[model samples]
Target: MPNGRDLGQDRGGDGTAASMIVTTKPPPANSPGKQKTVLLVDDQAFVRQIMWKALSATHAYKVLQAADGMAAINLMRDGGIKLEHAAGTDLMEAAAGAKIDCIVSDINMEPMNGLEFVKTIRVGMASVHRGTPVIMLTAHADKHFLSTAFALDVSGFLVKPVSGTVLVEKIERAIATPVALKSASDYATLIVPDVDTPDLYASVDAENEQSKTVRATDMAEQFSQQRPRFVAISELKVGDRLSEDLLTTEGVLVVPKGTRIAPALISALKDLSEIVKLMDRVSVVNV
Candidate 1:
């Protein structure tokens, strides 16, 4: 501990406010390179409990949770939920406290909203947290709120009702983006949707040629690709006239019998669940 700042410094005592208790623990096993602490700020107790449960199910994170901006700021300022660093641990003295790897906050709250919270933290953060990333979790999708949030320089945005999987993916992306930017030149691994992926079919060939009664299994059995490989699928639903515009647009994924998706893909799948359901409803309607 640097200046021996106690996390429990009484707030109502003398002209100063104290922070909360340490609900979350730091990563138990530090393997040289590991993610640092994360702050979860939300007003709703139920929501916070759910978030913590999901987070705890994974890696150990030193969490300093706050119900509102004031509480959050107190924890942010007083180093951590406890007495800064635990002595000889690699954790540095609570200057700004642990390197705040990321911040997840709700948008609609009293006094200050998510946007206001972000601006405040960046403005008053200890040197370590000044550049910390913030992911705005909000229920508002209207253009007005969206515009306001973007102006605040939010690192990422997760709509309300974001699942644990999606939240984690957003966190990983925001954290990695900075490192990726440093590398400069960018490259995307293109995925040619393989029709062989079970339950997916390619109605048109790569040459935009359509075949009557195309079978998905056949398309997957034989896919031709030159580059890294991105599967091209035909958009043939039961009854709708197979439209050529599908070729002009993007493609689909042809999953194998049982393809276990990576965490990132799982996040995508969950996020697109609504779209998937809609497609399913249409699929049920025989053309």
Candidate 2:
């Protein structure tokens, strides 16, 4: 089990948070090619060790452990690190090239907290693994915390004292589910072209519920009419907003209309251009 401090309790009737019971069991087996790559991030060494031991019990997974979010980013972005087995043996020297299937991370930590890490990967410029599923582990389940996690588009959330079995189950579910594709309605404008990914667009009603935080002025501005200017993707800047739906030659929706440009998104578009044919220029609002 993953350990954590209960925020609302002093179960011992003393001055300290209650301790958590740690447990471990062998992970379920899977087909040879079904073995997944998992990244576990936590500030505590003991938590990382227990979780790693639980996951590494079988050949069902190739696990990587990091003490904090920064370290986790390094492991995913840079690679070239030595992966060690539970028996103090070198499991693989080429772990740097491995693709991570899912990530389990704690919310609280120093240098880079889980929330910051999630935002960086999901929206940051150098994020190659932006679409990777993430399962957040936290001691607090407050409303604000949950809303932030939802906005970041995390795959799953778990409270502390989570069992290895449940963690494994969540990981499997997250990996099996494709990342939710953003609908044109999710933004201020609808520039949908020909989307062929799937029919699994998120419900507009559900999105509106989560979007309660949008300011009244912002809502008005979205409905406001503005002229559009065609700008080359290479010249797209951080503050520019899309005025039309950005699509690939195959009808895949990339960046939606009215979405603000970011450095990371620009880089991602450039890289995507090599594989798929994106329009030479995008239509942006003429602010």
Candidate 3:
């Protein structure tokens, strides 16, 4: 879900208009030690090189580079790219049959920016690329851009001058997440990187009706207010199921009203006094 209204264009980059440019996710279970490749797109050669090395070193994952949106999309849609080896091997070919596991694009570009790039892959055009998770890299992490990016279904976000540690964390979360093409995790660990944590909740039944809405602002207010207490958010398999288990010291129990909520995000609902009061106000349940 992308909110176009707040996707303000970036002012840097030596080229034209095209380019533009989350949470506690659990450490995906033992991760098969299978590191997926990531595509990094940005105009600056230095940025691309640095990011590629940093991500590769930090995650033991392969990295691809693109100068802008079109290149990134092309590399992603194309079958796959070959990295050198003693046998002159093809990593993506023998492995997953794709060059990239996910995309990390700068939101602002010359003509077709990151947002548009994501739309290109996720939209009606390509079957193989339709579900690739897209992460955003930016220097302008203003309130609007942050909220707007996620609205468009952006998987991850990082401010400019990111550290290797943070970049690895963000990339892992995105690649491990599901897209139209596939789901990222098979274990509960992927959903909540740090286990045994609690997040707060407030009622928002009115917005649940728009579960499929890709528009950013559509759920901005509610999502923003809840993030403070939302210690973590895992992707739920089903949507519109509100059933949840309140994390209390007294052995946990399930609340059956989750039909309207996404199971992955249910852990975000904590039972703090204020959170309980908020849920009560909205009549979402105080579980």
Which numbered prediction scores highest in TM-score against the true structure?
2
- Please give the TM-score that candidate 1 achieves against the real structure: 0.49
State the lDDT of candidate 2 residue by residue for 191-283, as single tens digits: 111112222122234456556446435744763777678888888976688777676555555554656665435433443432346777888
Candidate lDDT (C-alpha), each: 0.45, 0.57, 0.45
**Per-model root-mean-square deviation over C-alphas:** 15.1, 15.2, 14.0
Q: Point out where model 3 deviates above 4 Å.
A: 1-32, 78-99, 179-287
Worst 10 residues of 1 by lDDT: 180-189
Evaluated with lDDT, which candidate comes out highest? 2
**Model 2 stretches astray by more than 4 angstroms:** 1-31, 86-96, 124-127, 141-143, 181-287
C-alpha lDDT of candidate 3 relative to the true structure: 0.45
User: Residue 71: error of model 2 in Å?
Assistant: 1.2
Which sections of candidate 1 miss by over 4 Å?
1-18, 25-32, 83-95, 124-128, 141-143, 179-287
lDDT tens digits, residue span 1-287, model 3: 12111121223365442222200111245645666667677766656656765654444665555667775555445544444422333233322355467778876664556655665665434333566667777653222233233324566566677677777776676666564232222111111111112222212234443542443343443444442222122323344323233232332222322223432123223212211222231113212
Provide the lDDT at 204 for model 2: 35
Model 3 residue 192 lDDT score: 14
Count clashing pairs, candidate 1. Answer: 14
